[model samples]
Each structure stands twice: as structure tokens, then as C-alpha cells.
Target: PAAAADEPGTPQGPRAPLHGAAGRPAAPPAGAQPAAVTRTEIIDRAKTWVAAKVPYSMTAYWSDGYRQDCSGFVSMAWKLPANEWTGSLATVADRITKEELAPGDILLFHNASDPQEGSHVVIFGGWTDGTHTAYTAYEQTPPHTRRLDTPYAYWNNSAKYLPYRYKGVTAGKASTAGAGETVPEAAGPASHGVAGYPGRAMFGPGADNPYVTRLGRQLVRKGFGTHYTKGPGPRWGEADRRGVQAFQRAQGWRGGAADGHPGPETWRRLFS
Candidate 1:
């Protein structure tokens, strides 16, 4: 593939892979890890783990859990709660569901009081019959898989929820589940190039990275026009952040909320 070239005017340049920017084949995301064990199996095992260990507040740099907050449980289910950048369980719940939903989608429920009590979440691990079961890491509640239907409080209350479906879950791409389990559709990531810019430079400090281009793509989705161009730029800095912030403002994210600092909320909404 890399070695093959064009024959005369055969339009023979190396096209980037679909996974990369502008079809520019990107190296697979770095530091990526194989998902630990079969998800449901893990959840089933987690119940025993929760029973033995004491529940502590989540204190990872990415999470605000004094120990095992609702969002923290989801983060741990995906093994990335440490990837947190905000204190809002809403923010965490929003990000996980920002993608699509499958067997491993993380679910969240919130309250207004105790972290463990107010914010409760579960990791979707497929269904046992028509019932939904989840694996969660909590102290007050025993860790393990649970079915919230019959006696489990029948979840889905007024509290908002989001499910994060990890890529490459079923097959190499994505798949749809049958019946009972509710599957979410994808919000198209900016797969094609936008007006003006069309290279791997849109994600730089001023412009660079597929993730940054994603930011611009989000602006476009929210009904904003690109003031500049497209493609991955150089680095993600001021001008970039400003562009993002401006887009957020246009989206009516106010009250110092969407400050363009570019954290989880920004990515969740943008990537959503």
C-alpha cells in the first residue's frame, strides 16, 4: 500500500486511511489498550470486587469522585475515569454517550446530594433476556452486575444519561444489537474535508490534529461557519481555542460555562 505508487496520471498519491484526517492515514491512536476482558464478564466479576473492597471517593486528576462517584464508575468501566477534566457528573455522562451505544456503553444517573447517592451510573453489558444489566464500581453498593428492571428501581428517571460505546467493540468497526438492547446511531464525525483547508495542518497550535478539526466540525454542526479553513493544523492554542469558544458562544453556552478552555464538556458536545 505505502510502496505502491501512481502509474502516469492515474491519480496515484498515498491517500490517508479513513481513520486519519482528510483521509490522510493517521497512526492508530497511541497508548491505546485492549479492553480488559469481556465487558459483561468483567462486570459480573466486579460485584465480588466491590463487596470486598471499601468504597472510597474518586480522586483521579480526571474525576472528582471522593471515591466511586457515578461518573467515576463509568470512567473505571472504560478504564479512563482518570481521563477526567471536570467535576460535573453530567459532563462525564455526556462524554461517554457522546459517541454511540453498544454493549459496553456507560450509563449515568444523578441526584443533588451525596456523590455516591446522588450520582449513580452503570456500564451496559448487553441484556439477560429483555432486562438490562450493568457492572459498576461502588463502595456503598456492592460492585457487580445488576438488572434494574424487576426490583432494581427501573432506572431512567428524570436524571439525564449518556452511554459511551468504545470503538472497535464488535468486529473492527461497529455493529447493531438485536431487539431489547437499544442501540444509538452515530453522529457523523467530519469524515470529509471542509471548504478552503484540506491537509494535515488544521490541528496545530493555531489550527493541528484530527481532534482539533473535530472541534471545527462541531462548530459546523452547531450551525456556525468556519471563519478560517479546514484540515489538521499545527497546534491547538489561542486562535484555535478562540475559534472553539466563539462557536460555543454561538451555541448559546453561556455564564462562563463554555470558556473555550477545551475540556471534557467541549469535547463531549463537539464530538457529540
Candidate 2:
């Protein structure tokens, strides 16, 4: 029953990074672009980063830039298509559905009821071997660099990176049509394309088995969420599940229930 979800003193898990091993936020690889980064590539980079450190918020470490919050992180990670990219969590980037997620998918963690409420962002590294990790903007994460690892080891509150990671996909191959295929056209001076086309992250398209940590972070934030709240182990569980379900119901999800997996139908509603 939903009431059971509200149980206090529920066990949680560790904070997960949505990006990569927080090792040393390396400079973007030479000529790193979408064409070179397949969806699989995105996940690979994230895994490397996570095993190192954890992704942090630009606001927390560095402030005043194009992206400042969770969604902003997504913009930076996937690197938007252009400075004119039209989307935020409330706009373009916010259209993710659970099941549609893959590695490098950005998950926007925000207050469920407050439309203007700010949120955190985590890149999905979908499930792998019954465990998952993420790149996160955790407060303790290093300043101004993509951190890696940050394991979730749970199955709740995970968010997905939308449209961004899916930039140039053709069946399974990374699309190399336009140079602006993978990342945004406004990352740095002389924005370049990957290989032949502009590509995105190396994390795989529809990448599974490695992006669940972001989902776990989502659960931790809003699950038993409250002002200045903390949980056990950072793994989102009963409390987090309840919060996620409530958001889904408000979004008009059918038969809103927390069953762990964010399926396509679940995403359809969230995207709507």
C-alpha cells in the first residue's frame, strides 16, 4: 500500500554521480564531438569519471554561466546543439520519460509540487550487474570538473537524460550527418564536430545496465525529501519511491504506482 511507502527510518543508499568517476575532471578530449561519441561512448566516459570523483553543480562550485542547476548540467554534459537551444527542465530538456533513458541521459531532480522549484541533475548510467552508478553534482564533489563513480546500488528516484543523448542515432550506429549531431554547437571556442559529424557523449544510446545511479539520486532527493534532509546510505527506497509516485500521479500517469522500473508508458506521461 502507498501508506507503507511513508515508513520512517527507512534505509537508503549512497549518493550517485550522474556524470563519471570524479577522478580528475579531464579536459574534453581533443576534438571530442558527437560523431565520435556513440551512446556507448557516453557511458564509457561516465564510468571512467565516476570511478574517479563525482559530478557537481556549477552553482555549488562555479556559478554564473549558461547552466547553473541540474538541467544546466545536462546541457553541459550532452553539450547542447546551440546557444539558442530551446529547453530547460521546464522546456526542451525536461521531456524525459523513465524507460526512454540511457547512459548520459540527464535526470532532473526537483520539487514535485513547486513548478519553479530548483532541482539537481544526474546523468544516467543505466543498470549493470544489479548495481548502477551515476555522475552527480553532489555538494561534496570537487569544484568544476566531471566526477565519476558515485554508486546508487538501489532502484528508485532515478531520472533519465532525454533528447540530448539521442542526438544522432540510426538503429544502433551513431549518426554522422550534420556536425552538430551529438553535442551542442556552443561548448567552447570554435565548436567542432566529432569524426565527420558533430557527436555527443560516448555513453551508448538506449544504454542499459549502467545508468541507475541517477535514478537512485532522484529517490534520495525527493523521496523522503524535506528541508535540509538526509537519508541512510544514499540509496533511495520506500520514502523516495513515495515521492516519485506522487509526482507521476500528478503528471497523470496511468495507474500511478511505484514498481521500480520506469517503463515507456511512464515516460510518456512524464514527457507530456
Candidate 3:
């Protein structure tokens, strides 16, 4: 699993179940198409991802064959010809202030000196509180699509979030910025961001969390498991552990390392 700005660090080892949402939110309604998507459509597309509960992939994983990273997800929402990293994407937008943020605007986190190492972007879904300390947002993160409230990594520090709006996105005028251009469907992950799963602190056996469920889905997707006849829930059971070990074995890991417990190295490979 590649590290994204949303994640804090790797889990030391498997542990007891933690309390929280499964790091995923349900998708918004597909709704009726308007012949084409509008700026509102861009935001709606992002919401749809939340409803679908698409899993995150540091290698810029694709869901329904569309790239799914913070930037890639934004690109998909903006309907760009190709996926673009946050830096390049920022080039096309006009910088704005926090007070100017609105639906469809982007919240960016980038260090101009080293954009690739620690950068993230999210779609503004509006403020959640009166003081605006927290807000609703749409983002692609490790584990899956998120409909999140603020106090998140990229949003905590006012200095971290640089607000921006696409040039074509006007406040009172209709625009085609979200209509997007067509490009060849490409393979491979985006070249920006850390290359590993950086969602939770750790994923241990018997740990029923969204991270575990995410791992289970990835394992099944990669042909490592058939343990779940129904669906992979947020639980680290024998089947989930077995799938991890299988993936390790397939990667040629030896002895204890392949014993089914995921370490940083294992996560890197799994996410990559």
C-alpha cells in the first residue's frame, strides 16, 4: 500500500479492533444524467465514489476503470484527458482564499520544494461547522472513497491547504470544465505521492477495521483469496490472514515474513 497524505503511519502489527467508521462512506445517488456533467456534476461524481465505496490504491488504483488517487480522482471529477498530479493540476487553477471555497473547488496541500514526497488534494464539499474548523469533503484515500469532516491531515493547518478554483469554473456562469476531454485509457499508477499503503497505524489479526476489509478486497481482486463467499467486511479473521500469507508467498517472501502478518515491506508490495 503506497502512503498518501491521508495516512498517518503504518500499524506496528495486528492488534485489537479499533472503534471508528470503516474508513469508507457509501456513494451518492447516481441520479439522472444531464446529457453531460456540469461543475455540479464534478462534485456529484466525487460523491458517487463515496457511495460506491471504491478502495484506495497508492499505485493510483482504478475503480470502474478510472484512476483513483486524490489528484486522479479530482481529474476524473474535472474530466481531464489524463490524470494529473496536484502540482501540475494547480497550474490550471486560480488560487483563492479559504473564504472563497465552495463546492467543486479544490483544497490542495503541496510543498513547492518537494511536491511528490508529501502532497494531497481534496474536493471541497462545504463547511461542516459554524466556525468552519471542520468541513465535509470528498477524497480518495487508502481503503476507499471518503465523505469526511475536517480536522484531517491536509486540512488541520491553515498553511497546508491552498484553495484554488479552475479558471473555467465561474461563480455565476455555466461552464464545460467538467465535460472533459477523451484520452487513451492508460495503465500504471500516477508517478506522484508515496508508494505504499498509509491509511491506518496497523492491521493485526482479529482487528476488524476498514483497513482489514480493504486488504481483503485487494487480496480477492489480486486472486489471493476465495475465503469470502459473500463480501469482505471490516474484520481481520483467519481468512484475511490467509490471504495476506498467500500474497506474501506469491511475492516469494520467506519463512516468518510470509507467515501472513503484514509488515511495512509487505504493505509496500501489496499496495504497489
Candidate 4:
């Protein structure tokens, strides 16, 4: 049954462990391959609940078999093999920097001491602007699942909301080309007609040139355009950095190599 009120405040006293409709514990199914999800897939799944207005319930389970609460909402979005609570959600996700946040990532606040005092989670839709002061948040609370323009992190406990990305999530398939858009095919280093590795000076902060435009176009072609709300224009912006980083990470690069700056190798791979 749905809670009498929508707020996910902690219930008083000790509580029984929550489970799925099948009476299984809130953990991934044994011996199952983790779902290789995409950002689009995660956001699409989240929107279904928002559209359906799935009600909030700690004990009740939705038809999809996930608990109808904050953590369950994220589990459903990530398409985990089973339901997960705030305490266990991190097991399947990696902590990410705020700057690395992109659509389909989550801002999680797990209150380990109380489990519910003010713990919550919200899916990061995207930054509302270049300022990075706020974002579009998709969440399930009280009344139901909702999409909101929330402040950086959240309205309350803003400092506690940390970013995370699902481990199984991929860069996703190439985006369908819009009219007049050219979709670049994945190519090897020897592929003919690939562009030369533009000098690194053409990218990074405060650098703007035709190469920036070229890079943005190629990023769009390669399906990393989710960061760009309007133009992947010649201007070097956070969108460009994020797109580059996402592409770099897609290639299994990390640390300094995936720092979001396009070096010679990154440029070659992107063009390839």
C-alpha cells in the first residue's frame, strides 16, 4: 500500500528488511549478467514512472517488481537485476565528480546512521545552465515520480548529495542523425579519409576555433551529443569537455587520459 503521505521520512523504530514482490532480498539476482544500460535507456525508464506517476511506498512493490521508493526508483532506472536500497546502491555504481555528471547519473545521499533521516537519491537529468548551480532532477518521492529543476545537488542536504554512475552503463549506440547531420562510423586508425589529429591547443578552456566546431560535430556524429542542448558550436564549453570525456571513457581510458581534454590520441580516436 502507498504511504499515507508522500514524504520519505524515516519510520520510527527498527524496520524489517525490504524485499521485492517475489519475496527476494533487495540484491542483484545471482549469476545474472549485469544489464549493459545506456544513458538514454536509463532516462527513458525514469520518464515512464514520471509519466505513470508511480506512487511512493516503502513496503509496496511496483508491477516492475521494484520497491516504490527513492532507491528503488534508481534501481529501476539503472535496470538492476533486483531492487536495491540506499545502503547497497553504491555497490553497483562508481562515485563520480560533480563536473563529470551527465544525464542518467545520480546524486545520492545515503544516511548510513539513520538510513532515512534525510537520505535520498535523484537522477541527474542535466545541468540547467553553464553555471552548474542547478540541474534537472528526476526522482520518486511522496506523491509520485517527478521531473524537477532542482538546485545543485538538492534543495535540502545539498552538500551530502554525491554523484554516481552505473558501472554497466555504456556510451550508448550512435544517435539517429538529425536532418543535415552526418553520423560518423566507428573506424580504425588506418581508416581512409579520417582527419589528422588536430593540435591540443585547438581544445580545452578559453580556446575557440574551427577545430572546436569540428570536434563538436564529430562528437555529435559519434552519439555523445547529449551534453549539448543547443549548438555544439565553435565555443569551447562544459558540454564539449563532457562529450570528450565521455568519449575518452568509452574507450576504457581513465585517470589523466580521460581528463576531458582532447590530446593527440583522443583527437585521432575521435576522428577515426
Candidate 5:
């Protein structure tokens, strides 16, 4: 998911130099200290960068020496040790609902279990109105630090926009106040079943196995499991295959092309 360019950055007017003499990340904007930044300070610095129109690139890191992808941007703002991926980042955050979204929270798109279809993460700036139908957000997408509006065509297509709060940051303040928030690093490769895709691919109706069972569950989640009348257990029956085919068709592949097999794209979309 973090490997490809799903959303390209567009030209956001004039650009400012964001690197030091050796091309390292430049200093923080006015009023914010990188050593002990606050949640509000994080948002403020992000907003300032947006206003400065820093360019975006999936392969590049930010001026602060962090990867430039969605998750990388979050890690940079949150001040993590290295660039983090979307799947791993989700582990450190508590899932929240749209009603619970607040500044400093993350808005993510795509399946966290197995982010094959690709994923995007943005920082919630604030609500555009009281209705919560729309809101302002900041993200590193094509162009730079984009001020995104909710219900955006590409991001609002499915039940993928998840809200998350870093475990260290709290309701009204950072965990350590003057010392800034001390985010807990994710432990290990997150277990897939409950939080990610089971480490293996579920491409066919093989023998009864955990991968098949996981496939069935994903199919059911995608609303393509009409054939799963009994239940989606560990069995790899016709139901699972049919469900996969249906999902493939929905994704624009058809007939022989939509064979009930999981290819790279099919797997990505199914997990996504």
C-alpha cells in the first residue's frame, strides 16, 4: 500500500526551501520546538507547512527526514524513530468513529488487516461544520501538505475512512505537556486476523485452513458472500470461490478474467 502512488501531489503554487545546507530536514516553523512539541503544536506546524506549499512525493521523505508517504508523514509529525507503514501505525492508535474525530486524530482509508488496495492517512484538522458531513484535514499527498475536505470522492467510496487516536495523545492535551507526547512504538508485526490479513495469501479454494477462513471473512466484509449461506468457517468451499469471483467482477475484471482466483490486484482489492 505504501509502495505505490495512489494519490499524486499536485502543484500548490510557489514552493519554499525546506532543507539545510546538507539537504537534511529544515527547522520547525515559528513558535514550535521540535524537541518537545505538543499536539496543537504538531497541527500548527503541519498547517504552516501546508501554507508553505511543501511538495509531496510517495517515495520521498519530508524535510524533517521522514518518509513522504501517508504513514511516513504521520510518523514524522508524531516524531517516530523511522518511517512507519499504515498497517503498523494502526496498531499504536485506538480506532475512533467520525463523531469522535478531533484535531491530531488520523483518518485512514483502506483495509488495515491487509492493505493491498493501497491506503491513505490524513490528519484531522477540524470540522467544517457541526453536521460532521464534512471537515478539514491535512495530509501529504500529491502536491504537498493538502488541506482535505471530508466525503472526498476517492476517499469516501467505502467503509474505509477509519479515525484513530495515538495511544499517547489524550482528549485535551499531550501526555507529557512540556515534554510533549511520548508515543509508544508498535511492538512487533501486528497479528493479522483481528488487526491485519493473515500473513499468507488466500487465492483459492484449498483444503480447510486458516487462510481460506480469513478469505471468507474478508469476502463477507466486502458484501460479496451471498454464497456463504451456512457460515464462513475454516472450510474452502465453493462459497468462498464464488465470493471472490463476485468481488473480482465488481472490481471490473470479468468472465474468464474474473476467475475465482486471487492475483496480486485481486488480493489487494479484496483486502482493501
Candidate 6:
């Protein structure tokens, strides 16, 4: 028999049954309407597994009752009315462009001819830099759930991974600023003591400057400090990237706008 579509590697022995809320099968009810969700909520749901370090298994289910695999991770994150697999996921989502990629969207590579080979799906967290050559990917693979800085599309099968957006997603109340738009001056207390946004060159890989420190401190002040394990120092690190990404997502920014590298708009809102 072919391997499960979501399992990329050779199948392992069945995992010990999960011990928590009773296990539920990974099947959605007939005719269920997926609840409306926001981009922020989807990313938040995806992080729950990362926090719990949920193990991956095609046959197992998590306490919250989703299958413990790549597709199931996405089903839970999208808050779909029921579980979905690689084949069925697209029925509920629309194919999107790479430029349209945003937090909560997915980069899916499903193999219909052979379900196992390298078929998989990952939640698009945000871009790691302006180049769009890499991004933050949240996935459930062997060992556990992980948030990684992945190459465009994926490390393997780069050409096959296509971007998708869930049809039921709705933009939340926060205002979004697109790329190249002039970021208005912050209107409230957030503007106080906030320095102007330095050029983009001040941050990203190999950037070591006081502005990086300032950005890190402001991120911590704005409740995104958890990404930092130690100093929000002058040097840029994964923590800084993740912290900035979280702040950008909070503002309803997506795609290039939320690339973790702070643009002028991201700066205005973070300080605001």
C-alpha cells in the first residue's frame, strides 16, 4: 500500500495512543461549513502545537481531535469544521500567488500520482527577509511540530509547492499597510519616544546596529518578547525576526508587508 499522503518519510510503527481528550477520527462531518477565521487566529492555532511539541503520526490524533500529521496541522490551524487531507484541502481553499502569500496561507505540494514521495503542506508564517527567497514555515513533521526558516516553497520540490489561501478567512479589524505605501505617523501614545524607522538596511542578516537593539526593545515592550531567549541585543537573530514577524501579523499585515524585516509602516505601528 502507498504511504499516507501527509507522511513524507517512511512510516514508523504506530505511536502510543495519545492520552488526553478522547481521540477523534480525522474526518469532517457531511456538509459542514468551515467557520470564518482570521489570519491572526490561524497562526495562533498553528502555534499551539509548536508550544505543545505535538508528535507527528498519520494514525494518531491530538487532544483537540485533529489527525497528527501535516494536513491535520493545517486543518486545526484553519479551524475547519472537520479534518482535511492533502487532496481535500484545496476544495476549501483557492490557489494563490507567491506574492499573495501571507501569514495563515499555505504552501502545499500534494502528489496525486504517488501520495507519499515528498507530498506535504506547511503554514506560511511570514517572510524572513525582503528578498522573498525564504520564509517562516510552521509544520508538523517527524519528532514534533516546528517553526522553521524554510527556503522559498520548500527545501525540496521547490517548484511544486504552490501557495493557497483558505476561502473562509476574513481580514480582522486592524488596518493593513501594503508594500511601498507611506506609513502615516502614529496617532497615539505608541508614538511617544519611538524613533523614526531607519532604512531597511539596518536590519536582517548580518546587521549589527543600535537600531536593531531599539527594534528589539520595542518588540519586547509591545508584548512580543517571548521570541527572545536572551538579549534583544544590537545583533540581529532568529528571535528578532520572529518578534518582528509577530508584531507585523498583529497589524493585519501579510505577504511582503509582514516579511519580518521592518518597513516604515511596520515601524510606525510598532512604535504607535
Per-residue lDDT of candidate 3, residues 29-111 (tens digit): 33312123344456656866886787665454454334556777776676554455666667657798877676677888865
Model 2 Cα lDDT, one tens digit per residue, 1-272: 34322312211111222233343243344333433244444443343334444444333222222233334344434443311112333333335454555555555444445423333345665433224343222211223334333334212333322223344422233322111123342222123421221122212223222223343344445442331144332332333335445555555544414332233333233323
Q: Residue 1 CA error for candidate 3 (Å)?
A: 22
Task: Please estimate how well model 4 matches the true structure, expressed as its whole-model Cα lDDT.
Answer: 0.72
TM-score of 1: 0.31
Question: How do the predictions measure up, each by TM-score?
Answer: 0.31, 0.33, 0.48, 0.59, 0.48, 0.62
Cα lDDT computed for each candidate against the true fold: 0.37, 0.35, 0.57, 0.72, 0.56, 0.73
Which parts of model 2 are misplaced by more than 4 Å?
1-37, 40-69, 81-87, 93-97, 112-118, 130-272
Candidate 5 stretches greater than 4 Å from native: 1-37, 112-116, 152-154, 171-272
120-238, model 5: which lDDT tens digit per residue? 77787655444556556678776566665655213533366778876656323222111111212221113222234332222221234577777788888889889987768774555
For 67-166, candidate 1 gives per-residue lDDT tens digits of 3433444444444423221234233233553224444455555444433333445555332222333221222233322323211222334235445454
Kindly report which residue stretches of model 4 are placed more than 4 angstroms away from their true locations once superposed: 1-33, 174-272
Model 4, position 230: C-alpha lDDT score: 86
- Candidate 4 per-residue lDDT over residues 100-138, each given as its tens digit: 887788999888898768888889887656688977788
Q: RMSD of model 1, in Å?
A: 23.7
User: CA lDDT of 251 in candidate 2?
Assistant: 50
CA-only RMSD, every prediction = 23.7, 19.0, 19.2, 11.3, 19.6, 10.6
The order by descending lDDT is: 6, 4, 3, 5, 1, 2
TM value for model 6:
0.62
Clash count for candidate 1 is 38
* Shift in Å, residue 38, candidate 1: 5.8
**Best model per lDDT:** 6
Clashing pairs in 4: 6-142
RMSD (Cα, Å) of model 3:
19.2
